[model samples]
Target: MLKKEQFLSYSAGAIVAGMYCGKLELNGDFFAGYEYGTGISPSLDPYFRSEMKRLEKEAEGDLKSYCSLARLMFYKGNKPKPLVAPLLIDKP
Candidate 1:
């Protein structure tokens, strides 16, 4: 029985993941034509800025969901989930 806010937050995380993936795919071509190689165009800059803010909001929403889930599980006497590990680790 997840709360409405929890479900909405999960959906927001999916949307943010999709948005970032799409941005990464287009960045190369979209940025290739920009002047000074800074990848910022007069027309695209505003759109990019807005997208960044949206992404941040979505990420915050997801964090809230995770925290809520963690708290719920803790109160239920369940162990906390392990943190996700880094993809690459250096050997000593």
Candidate 2:
């Protein structure tokens, strides 16, 4: 059986997929105007930052490094725009 956090992670991924494909309504506490890639708060979670730091070190290749930088910008906000935006798809 999946652990609680693992289940939630899968469920959240499913929700994101559904929303992106226009199968789900974008109405929720989680959906708050980060759609058009704006309004992200700059408050970085300490634990998340630490985890990212570890992952960043493990990350290989320029693309991986770029993706890490994009994720960091996503959480902390207000950095220069990434060369390619993070893979989050918006509603059509």
Return the TM-score for each candidate structure: 0.26, 0.25
TM-score quality measure for candidate 2:
0.25
- State the RMSD for candidate 2: 13.7
Error of 2 at 27 (Å): 18
Task: Estimate candidate 1's alpha-carbon lDDT, on a 0 to 1 scale.
Answer: 0.35
User: lDDT of each prediction vs. the true structure?
Assistant: 0.35, 0.35
Q: What lDDT, from 0 to 1, does candidate 2 have?
A: 0.35
The regions of model 1 sitting more than 4 angstroms off are 22-92
lDDT tens digits, residue span 1-92, model 2: 33333333323433333333332222333334332244332223344344444444443335444444444332222346423222232334
Global Cα RMSD, each model: 14.6, 13.7
Instruction: For residues 1-92, write the lDDT of model 1, one tens digit per residue.
Output: 33333333333333344343222112222223332454334334454455556656755677655343333322222234312211111112
**lDDT, candidate 2, residue 46?**
46
